[model samples]
Target chain A: MRVSAPVRATVQRLTLPFLIFMSALLAVLGKADVLLFDRVRVVLADVLAPVLQVAGEPIASVSRAVGTVENVITVYHQNQELKLENQRLLQWQEVARRLQSENEELRNLVKFAPQGAVSSVAAQVIADSGGAFLHNILVNVGSREGVARGQPAMTGDGLVGRVIEVGGRTARILLLTDINSHIPVAIEGTHDHAMLNGDNSDEPRLVYVQPKTPVKSGDRIVTSGSGGMFPPDLPVGVVASVGGVIRVETYADLARLEMVRIVNYGLDGILPDGWVPTPQAGRRSHARAASSP
Target chain B: MPYSRNRDYVGFVARMVPGTTTFLFTLLSLLPFPVPSFGSIAPSFALMAVFHWTVYRPDLLPPGAVFVAGLLLDLLNGTPYVGLSALALLLVRTAVLNQRRIFSHRPFSVLWLGFFGATAGAFALEWAFVSLMQVEFLAPRPFVFQTLITAACFPIGSYVLALAHRAMPALSA
Candidate 1:
């Protein structure tokens, strides 16, 4: 009743080619957003999240231990630097206080109800998108924590990325350095706007700047809230360099991210969730704005 | 003698050890370690496992296992472009299987050299496919670094797999 060895060999020979075809088909399906493929991904993420969390804990602990040792070695230098930095910060604090009061007076005169405070949920990164071609991480917080697709994920340092997929208990964040990431941001001093595009590189590139825009190296960058994909004025990073091309050195040392805040600024007016503009709606909005003015 | 069949059944289940262990190793390899400029240095520990098993235990480690491993990695990594590492891993397995006649009895250095060839081919295919998808020339540095690092990691992986092989009970052919 045993199968023939020749038949088994033929099946083995066909296996590789069939898999190759399936792989390409899956890729195309994934790219095309085929519903079944998408569901498989979500289910896979839900299944893998727990295993990743358990595995990541040991590595995170070991790294924390190593950081402790390194910190001890540099404590003296750090202390001296902190003292010098504190002196400069005190001077800046005086200027900041004056500006704060002046801004408040201006807002009161205009009857501005300044934007409501944004609430955020903190989550730990349980898994990393490990391939060099990709930059994403799965976090423990998800829909149950009020997490949603398009919510911004960040650390104390700066903007990390936006949530691409939200599961019941886990979510996947598309990192700033991911090739698909395209963020509209502004330079602090020059106020020149540019799109930050990740090319799967360490430093994401700043593209679409006006050639005449006076952008310099080391300029600070923040989200401009232009398209409302993210909250305005979130600290992004410094313009790392402005040679032939502009590069951003993100404030969130992406590799070191352990926990992140998923912020819901709630003013996503420009591209609000579920607000698809059909031709009729676009015309109606145009007429309304014109008549109101 | 009657207990021999039960022991044989145990051997059949034991054969699954390498695949499960290799799958776990693949998952662990994907775990993030926060280090500067270490993003591209994700050594293909999983690639090494595939090569080791395909060469040493071809019958035991089948193509389905490789495809599932690759598919899961693709799904997890979110690279619709790498189509996941599934196609790449299978190609490597096929290449290694073809070279088994020459590689099975070879020395460690020769095996490492063979891995270099397979890695180069895999990287080339990956780079070409990714570039075609983008319709622009994507930088090859990350892929190159990954190839070099993964290739460098081959010996350590092979050593570990060899140990795992020794520790498992022998299969009755």
Candidate 2:
């Protein structure tokens, strides 16, 4: 096992380049036709699935316990808090009722309401890339569960991220806070469109906004859904001034993210003139037709 | 003859373990855990691990392995290219290797300073490359905080790595 000095030096010299070459090869191969690598990535993820499940279980238990404790604490203030919250919710409920009726009336008037349907599944976070330079999470869902690449994922709070790589029983989510993540968003107050760009830092930057547009701190941001990648009007975060830069303080707390819902909204066929199957209609089609002939 | 052979086997295992540990440490650092709205910066756990091993067990952990670890990190994290981290890690290893004599005799304060200096260099390199790529305003504060957090984790990581070194009879030689 005692290596000669020359052998040791040679080994040292070769190591870095070899690793670099392998990494480059992996990156290049990963980019070739998402479908090809998508399958491979899935298989690899499946192999890693058990690891994620084991890692995630303890975190999930802790989070659930924390949630239970918070619920119990809130119960002490429940009466007073609920009174105030109930007043606010009642106002919202009235508005919601009106909106529901109005939306129904509008849909009937339009005659041809786009009959798009959506299906959803739940997934657990297995592992997280928690560093200053990357923001991705491995989830325990894959192509087996009909989870596809580009599917939008969210927490109960708001937009968490989207699935970028799906494996057989696992998928990697590119968090909205990742440096490489960019989503089209709009300001709730001003209706100004901008791109929410993740810079490997927590607070995402609001880019592509007009200089003259009035955007202020505390302004809410939501997905504009212009690309049809995500549903429209999903709450993103509030605009907060960090130093002088306006940044979104996302609603979903990533630190405590344990479970997430993977929305099955088909973005591909939802756009004009596409033929993607809608979940609800597809499900109903299997049942007896109401009226024939 | 058997005793000498056993010693060689122990030394080989000692040398190899650090490489595997370096890889595992890099993977742990790259785990996608999101920090609060400090911006996208998470703590540099891998950097801390590398710094610890290089400071205490240079024979076990080599410069080339450090570079590879950095490249692996870049790939796993889905960064722009390989050289960004490789270059930073190379610089850190070079600095650590060169100053090993001064650090070996000095107290913990000097070792801490060396770590700070190395981290500063690595952070500056990362920030500069990221900025050059036209992503300046994402969240500089988080990175700053992350650097501070990483620096804080150093002494503990160094202590643990030191313990690991002591546990292995071969590395002590």
Candidate 3:
């Protein structure tokens, strides 16, 4: 297996350029034909899920320790804040009780049909894309845990994002701040609909707003259920700014996500598996859906 | 003969240390760090590994290995552009190879400074490629932030690679 000096040198000289050219080609064409990459990514992610979880254990404990220390230092101040919050919540509870009875009576009068049961699974964040241009998290739960694509992932505070890629034991969540994310949302109270678009920033921009209602800073945004991808009225975020690009500050702390609930609202707005057999076709349909105003 | 075989085995593992560490570093970059806003701008540990090895032991971690490491990173991170990392890393290796003389036998600060330059180049290339693909000028703030973060974290990444490099003396080169 001995090679001549000229031949070996030629091969060595060409290797770098060849690989660079190949990579450039792949980068340009990868999005158009993502089926191969998707399969490889899912398998690789599933295989490495345990490793990521185990590696993240120390980080999780360290953050928890930091949180504990902070809580201890601020316990007295927190107690005062909690007491006032409790009093306010109690008043709301009384109001909610009255509304519940009135709503029940109205529902009986209208013979309204009850909504179906919603199912959800809790998943731990295992991996982060960690790229400047990407805002996705890989959770340690997937199809085996009943996780499905297009299901909303939320923290108790609010919507985090949606499950886009699901493996057997891992699912990747496209956070609300990812460039490709486009969730249909509405301003609270006004019910004026807009699209929440991610630009790889901490705050996602609110676009396609109804000109009739002026969006103001501090106005709440929630899922509009327009595209059927998400149910109506799931808490999203508050409008951080109204001028130039309307930005939303998500209620869920997407930056420090620990756990997310991927809930199946029983909505089938996403195309079924049979409709788009290939992953590329599925991605094209998704692109079309996201592009539509 | 048995003793020689044992020596060969040890030497083989020693040679593998660089490639193994690069792969591990790629995996390390993907681990979910609980720090606020850390995930989107996690330091490029894989690039650090490639840079370290390209400067110290380019023969062991060849272009092929670097390409595979980048591919593994892109696949594991779930980036839509499958080869962007590979391209960036290969370019880094090529650039580092040319300037290896400057880093060789230099103090830690010089290596760190060189790494900073490499980080800037890699991130700028990414920003340009992505903005071009997207057909709009992307906000450059994150790319700048990531470059600084990656450069700032180089000492740690380089220290880890140095520890692995210590085993290279055992290799039968």
Candidate 4:
């Protein structure tokens, strides 16, 4: 059926406003129920995983090339630094060896059973959220590779984040600097519990400190394992500042994440296989209760 | 008749260039760039594509395509606000379409300046919307940096789109 020119023009004019309104509505409602989007996101990510991997090849090579050139220029300086570091590590190695033997003896005395077996997979960083307000990375390894939601992703330095969304061939890790990310962490030496909260900043802030022990700058932060989401004693970061809001400089260089090891510590934790926890969910309360003891 | 059909097919593919490039740029923005100190802010290549197509071939890249591109971006980014980018992009296209003539046949500097304004508006809107949604004053540093970085990189995105733009006329012929 052919419409009048005037009628067609009116419909065309209305389309823009209709779409704008619909998008704004979706944006508002998206916060209420992310389950739908989460499903779509994972499937879409899985489908596009190959395309992203192929496209990222050139960029990866270029970055590696640049790294090699920089390495050559800084070779002497790095050599000096590595020599000093090696000497320090050698001393620590001796202490660690002694402690291992003593710990084994102690364990035998107590008849203590070791924790369950741990498994991990190394994954390449294939995509980034690339949004000003978002901080997440998509890795090549996913459910097909034994990755599960809430598993901790780490680098050799320390904790990077946790796998929040896992598809067939890809997984999205919510970095410690995302606003919605809140991990139960503690001061390393004191074991004083606090929450490491990401406020969309380079350095995540430390909240809920016991205050009895004033956290000073350079205090090491580690996962408290209160929620069972992460295993105990995962190194997170060091306190960068002690101002109004204490910030943590993550040991893992989040700026240039090339690879991550997604570790499964064999704990079921707060999130089950398909449970996507909203920011306002009761999991935080559960974590609080679990940690109080 | 066969020759005309061939021309028609070529014309169809040429018409598809704008939409295809917009989607490709959307994907390009998601790729990890590996730039040191870049953080999470990749330059919004989708915005450049939309701005270019809207100014030059608005008939080809319509509002629906822009909305889809933005939706794809938000979904891939895994943000809670699924349609925020869609809304922002739609507004950008609408704003650009209104003043399309000014950007047409203009100097590169003028277009760059206009994009700078659009980038600022888009990011400022995002910063405000996110802060409001979270019910707190979110830090503005990343948004500010993104806007600046996007605008600064406009020349590169524009150059790539310009090459594709040049290929369009030949395809139609």
Candidate 3 lDDT over A226-246, as tens digits, reads: 768899999999999887999
lDDT of 1 by residue, A195-282 (tens): 7878878899987775787678888999876665776789999988888878999999886677899998875544344332122333
TM-score-wise, the better of 1 and 2 is 1
In candidate 3, what are the lDDT values of residues B55-160, reduced to their tens digit?
9999999999999999999888878889999999999999999999999898999999999999999999999998887767889999999999999999999888
Better of 2 and 3 by TM-score: 3
Residue ranges of candidate 3 with Cα displaced over 4 Å:
A1-9, A80-84, A87-91, A271-293, B170-173
State the lDDT of candidate 4 residue by residue for B1-173, as single tens digits: 99999999999989999999999999999998888545467899999999888888899998899999999999998888999999999999999999888898899998999898888889898899989988889889889999989998999999999999999999999
Q: Over the stretch A221-245, how does candidate 2's per-residue lDDT look in tens digits?
A: 9987666667778888998874566
**lDDT of each prediction vs. the true structure?**
0.78, 0.68, 0.88, 0.90
Prediction 4 global C-alpha lDDT: 0.90
TM-score of 4: 0.94
In model 4, what is the error at residue B153, expressed in angstroms? 0.7
Task: Name the weakest run of 10 consecutive residues (lDDT summed) in model 3 chain A.
Answer: A273-282
Give Cα distance to truth, residue B125, candidate 3, Å.
0.6
**Which candidate, 1 or 4, would have the higher DockQ against the true structure?**
4
lDDT of 2 by residue, B1-173 (tens): 99888888877877776677677666555443433432245556677767777777877777667776776666444443445666677667767877888788789989888888888778876666556544354446556766787787778767766666666774525
Sorted by lDDT (best first), the order is 4, 3, 1, 2
State which candidate, 1 or 2, has the greater lDDT: 1
Question: Model 2 chain B: which ten-residue window has the lowest total lDDT?
Answer: B30-39
TM-score of each: 0.87, 0.73, 0.92, 0.94
DockQ of every candidate: 0.51, 0.27, 0.65, 0.75
Q: State which docking tier applies to candidate 2.
A: acceptable
lDDT of 1 at A43: 80
